[model samples]
Target: MSEATETEKPASSSNTTLTNAQKARIERNRAKAENLRQAKLVTHPYKIGPNGGPEGNSVIKVQGTKYIDSGGGFLLEQPVLPAPGQKSNAEAETPVVIDDGINIPVKYEECLDCGDQFADSYLFNNFGHSVCDKCRDTEDRHSLITRTEAKAEYLLKDCDFDKREPPLRYISRKNPHNVRWGEMKLYLHLQVLKRAMDVWGSEEELMRQHESREDKREVGKARKYNKQMKQLRMEVRSSVYTKKTTELHVHEFGPETYNEEEDNYTHACVSCPYTETFEKM
Candidate 1:
């Protein structure tokens, strides 16, 4: 009985050793397969559009090739599936709405020159015309006057004076009689000059305020001139006289009463005595 037990124990030990060796071999092959998989590369397919068709049917399809490595020993290529028959080239053959200048919709009106929609049009002030902004800017560059210049001209027109003379004063006159007209003209000229000065002064002030400390010296004269002009205008307005004259004049005519030798003579004041004689009577 003891000898049979010893033989069985040795047989069981040999079986255990064989089983462990087989497991180690299997594990090594698995590790080799995992390493090959990590080194393997894959490629994906590219696609374009799946635009809709007239019948409302649409389809998406992938093009190009794909390759996969199952193991180091084998390379497999994926088979391409043809697009479904219902996905025929319907999108490519679909008809687009085109206008033939007749029966065209109002919403689709396009500019003839630019090929852009009419809704994006702009109005040009020069010709009082409508055009696209791009075309308008181009025209403005070649225009005789830009929008800014046009605005300035309009402003000047607003303050322009009539060339015709005023009513009831057909003859040329001077001094006190034409004083009102002269004063009015002078006032208008002064107002215009004042506005011009203010505009210039504002621009200069802006430049001076923005300049560096080193550049402010360049603006000193302009600052001084602006100050002097403002002061002068104020003083003139306060001290100027704008009175109207009211005096009568009489002309005397006596025949052959001139002093021949001197050719000139002075007259004396005259008085009446009828009231005093009547009172005495």
Candidate 2:
């Protein structure tokens, strides 16, 4: 043979046998390790998607030369999809972790809120929790990007939310007895938009460090508050999704509490384009 690679590693010449107790101990240790691995809170460095160039673009030579001469197979077209009831070989088989000598360890991760186990690669940008992709979709989310921040904040603080608007109209096709179902839906949607302010307020407080304190006994209280607020924000996307329509009844600011200087807000989404429609009304 020209050379034996890792995939072709030879088996040990000596035969070995383990006692039942030893085998049981190994199984126990594996279970314990798997549990601990799933409980990790922070993201690991190695568990990342392909970010750079050549390594990420895994280009296999489809058509190459013999020695240095000709070409190969697989290229020029998009991959063919499998038939309805069929699956790719990779999906059909059960997972098997193999130690091909070089060693690629199996990985597991868990969401903090839902405690669901998933590959770390499926992790999404969670609002305030160590959540998975599924939880991230439902949890309240606060997007702090350059594009969304201004609009979200305006809808949060300056909007005159408490000002009730004209009721929305919709039809119920299911049953005549459920004719008012459309009205109930409108109320539900209104509540969802109102919650956007709640999410926005929590985020603002965390950023403003309003919860921060300098007392001898409360030096770290602010940080703890910040964490609580951050976690609370993770539910924002879910709140927004519950009622998708945008309207002026959605309030982000008022005089009763949170911030004292926000007196200009009259409980509605004003100054914001969302309130422009209500300006004439």
Candidate 3:
């Protein structure tokens, strides 16, 4: 090699300088990472992931935000409550106890058809069998027009306000159109039923405790435990219930669906007797 010139005797460091484009790209990446970090911090607010430290700064994280269906091909960007007319998949999946002109749902003891709650002497059915006031009235009016009898007899079996209905049953002409009314029951209030369920759980716990203490030989102690169990049973039997009415938009009357010949006249001739059928013509 030739001898170096006076001013260029030694070479500078060999590290390559970054171009303007490269620098700009690096800056954009850094800003994106910082924004992600801030979002993660906001969502969690407690602790960051394992790669949150400065030593692991290259690993960027984006917090997950819950999304709901927007009825489009993609999910909504943010979470939102379902629209009033729409029901979540979860709510729609619950089993419903359907009745004539009504639907009794244990969720709120409201009518599945009209979302009305049961109350008072308007109806007497066993648990889980409920018809709303409006639906029941409609059915009664329809029954008056269609049933063989003007008013069906209601044999009261058990009746205690908010707690129990008198064991009630009625015998009609045993028509194929009507169901066995004796075995059917109305759904209790949701919150009250929840209370009863909690009481049942407590009763079970108490029973376990009683069983554990059974080894003791005190006759009076046994009596006390028996009394406790009786009380719990009575509590379960006498649990309070509720009645509520909620107006929800439901499907209109359709002979093929909502109203059959059994209760409504949609599919039957209006002036025809209960024994009569509509002509195909």
lDDT of each: 0.42, 0.42, 0.43
Q: CA lDDT of 15 in candidate 3?
A: 36
lDDT of 1 by residue, 195-271 (tens): 43444465465355446433666688787986787666656655433444463533342323334453334343233
Alpha carbon deviation, residue 279, candidate 2 (Å) = 37
RMSD of 1: 23.7
C-alpha root-mean-square deviation, each candidate: 23.7, 42.1, 39.2
Q: After superposition, how far is residue 105 of candidate 3 from its true place, in Å?
A: 56
Which 10 consecutive residues of model 2 have the lowest summed lDDT? 272-281
Off by over 4 Å in 3: 1-16, 43-281
Q: Considering every candidate listed, which one attains the maximal TM-score?
A: 2
What lDDT would candidate 3 get against the real structure?
Answer: 0.43
Between 1 and 3, whose TM-score is larger? 1
Least accurate stretch of 10 residues (summed lDDT) in model 1? 272-281
**Model 2 Cα lDDT, one tens digit per residue, 37-97:** 7654333222334442122222334455111111233233223345668897567686878
Name model 1 segments beyond 4 Å from true: 1-77, 80-144, 156-281
RMSD of 3: 39.2
Local lDDT at 5 for model 1:
100
